[model samples]
Target: MQIILAATPVVLLIVLLGFLKLPGEKSALITLGATILIAIFGFSLSFGDTALSIGYGVTKAVFPILVIILMAIYSYNVQVKSEKIEIIKQQFSAISKDKSVQVLLLTWGFGGLLEGMAGFGTAVAIPAAILISLGFKPMFSAVVSLIANSVPTAFGAVGIPVIVLAREVEMTDQITLISSHVVWQLAVLMFLVPFLIVTLAEKSVKSILKNILLSVLVGTVTLAVQYYAAVYIGAETPAILGSIASVVVIIVFGKLTANREVKDSYLNFSFNQIFQAWSVYGLILLLVLLTSPLFPFTAFMKANWDIFQTNFNFNVAGTLHTVGIYWLTDTGVLIFVSSLVGGLIQGLSLGSLFSLLGKTTIQLKKTVVTVCCLISLSTLMDFSGMITVLGLALATATGALYPLFAPAIGALGTFLTGSDTSSNILFGKLQATVADKIGADKGWLAAANTTGATGGKIISPQSIAVATTACGQQGNEGVILKKAVGFALLYILIAGIVVYLGS
Candidate 1:
């Protein structure tokens, strides 16, 4: 009875959002209400404690999470308004008349770069749009982009997902350990990504064999850089550096393999134009690095911004709630500054930048509500001990088989929430708890929650919606979902098996 009651919110979420096809925002609100009731009555949590959790959760969703979305979308809008997006598209198209090569570069290389910088669904949406503009069918473009985004996802948005998982598990000291485990677990996916993309795009495994060398080289480069960055550098560096390395290697390979007779004019863009278009992203990277723990001046920044910190703590029903806010040092601030600087470099006036920001905020109104409500629901369940109860049940039932279900739980979190970060936020602690109970490696299991979330990226309704809209096939979400679900399943299965063995 306790297990069933504990799982009621999650089950209802899956039913409403996954099966009934309800809007996420609506479902989130309904689930939030349900969670509050359960927390207050069923779990004996005081109303005050539940309300504090809600406030904490909503605050978190608003600051870095929702603010990141607003900034990323605004940055993209600035590029679009300035027409730099078109130039970037033309430059990619000129690389190869071979539609397959173009698709691989744009979707795998370029898309991976975006994922590293912004994450969420920007990686899929932007690349799918680029592929469509380059003449690929909307559905095909969406499918390939979705698949390509998976390989780089764990480290996406500068490793926020992994960092969040570490914090939630109360194992911040073991972040490097968790990151290493995640990188090793993802090694299989990295090597398979190139081959998988070719198979998905061409609808034939034979094509992967035909282009075996290119596929092998691309995969090798991706895996090598991803491993090095995640292990040696920092969590935020892996996807960015890995994707960049893959693109460079692929381009060099393409140049070498080309028939001697064909000259491609795609490299014709002036260096200045290219620099302007890419400078904003460079700025973001620089800022992230500067503010990152890796930088020498990080201490100075943190000390100077102490005044901006906000802390709240309360006790209700024997539960302790402590939340902290660091406004000045938030990643969102860096992203927003980078967006503005990029817009200026692209020749947008100050007024225009503010106008675009306003529009983006309005557009994301529903997203704001959705994120807040969902986060609140997750927090309430957590504080109410519902999440712990569920995790305990799973740990006991699975026993030695717990590793096999690790990725499944991760995939379920993402499939319901449609965001890897959200999935980690919801289930990372739960995974940690289960691992502790089962005597499994806590870091490995926590990291698995994130690595596994990547598999659900293609099938997420939010991702499908973004892909369809970007490809100018807004109402064709069902078609894209049906086409992508098979790939999603295979990816998750492979992820689960790999994690099971690793554990």
Candidate 2:
């Protein structure tokens, strides 16, 4: 009865958010409130402990997502307000404007680039907007962008997941073997992304053939660069290098392909025109690139001041670790710089930027509140031992079926918690613990956790909010989540099989 009651909120949330057509922000809060009240009474969690747990969970879940949300919406508002985004779109138009090419260039190339550079929802948000503007169906555009965003995510933001998973989770008996194997499997998965895109477009063979050549070319370049970086130098540079390499490849090839007919009109790009892409992004590049540890500049920055990271930690499964990293120097700094540059480049006055900031703050109030409440709710669940008990229970129930169900649990954790990093924190230790108890390959279980968590990033309500809002489908997050469920489940199952066999 206790277990059944403890499980009620999560099950209700899944049903409400997934099938009942309940609004996202509303459903999360309602579920959270009910769970907390239940915890206080039915679970016999002392009010103080329950409150503390809620505080901790919110801090853990909200911190990472807060960074993503502010930066993302701010980035979007800046680009849209300043017109730099418009300029970027215009440049794409000077070339081929085929909706499909638009998908390939923006959703596949630019989306991967963002995932490589920024990760989180920014990858989908920015690319989704571009695809919507380019005339793809809105729902289709959001789904395609979400799917494409995954290919580069394994290494995004300098391979955050790979590094953290290696350092924090015991994914294998031979740590090196497990780490490298996980990367390899993800790389193998990358090969199918282009095929997935074509399949999403209804599998037209003739159309597939046209894209097949380009797809292989694009995939090879990205996969080779990513794999080599992961195997050599380090994981910290794969996302940056892979994405930058692919962007250059696609833009060059795309321009050349369209140049024949467009040569006399808008095809010619001067140095000034080339620099145009950097307007909204120039300072962002400086902040993330220079501040990245894999770069020498980050070293220089670290020497000057505390490298601007805010660390937050809490007890998890009776253990503690540094699970939260706020790169105040990286993307946060970029947001400030973007506001300034976006204003200047777009010709907005300083006063206007401030005014816009004020308006944006007000505009995003509900979003901010919603995120804060969700984080607190998730944090409460974690600190109260709710998330751990739930996961361990599932692990025990699945038993020998763990391989098939392992990834789903990880995915489900993040689907509720809203960020993969948090999912890792909440469940990583438990995954390893379970693996040891069962005599299963602990490392394989850990890898399954991270890979599975990645799959959920595309389907999480938090993710849906980010993508839908970015795709201009705000308040319709339920529709988007429903639309992507098929692909997401298939991906999760495939990842499960891969982990099982590899293990």
Residue-level lDDT of model 2, residues 1-503, one tens digit each, is 66676678778766776788776677777887887887778767777666666666666444555556556666667777766566577678776644455567776676776666666667777677766655567788788887776656656766677666666674323444444555665655665766677567546666676566666777788778876776675656766777677777766666666645564566455666556445666666656666666667756655665646566665544556454454555564566676577567667788877777677556555455456556666666665567777888888898877877778777877776766666777777777787888788877788677677877777777677767666656656667778888878888888888877776
Model 2 per-residue lDDT at 169? 70
- Clashes by residue pair, model 1: none
For residues 1-503, what per-residue lDDT tens digits would candidate 1 score against the true structure?
77887889888865666566566567678888988988888998887788888887887666556776566656667778888877777766556555566777878888898788767666876677667666778788888988898878888877888888889999887777787888888888887777777666666555555466667888888878877787777687788888899889777766665554435454577888998887666777677666655555656755786787777765646766666666655666777888899889989899998998898778777667776887677767767888667756765787788887787677766765567887898789878887887788989999889988988776766566556545655445546666777888888888888889988
Off by over 4 Å in 1: 114-146, 157-178, 204-206, 210-214, 230-236, 254-262, 308-328, 412-447, 456-486
**Whole-model Cα lDDT per candidate?**
0.75, 0.68
Instruction: State in Å the error of residue 435, model 1.
Output: 5.4
Q: Which candidate leads the pack in TM-score? A: 2
Give the TM-score of each candidate: 0.83, 0.87
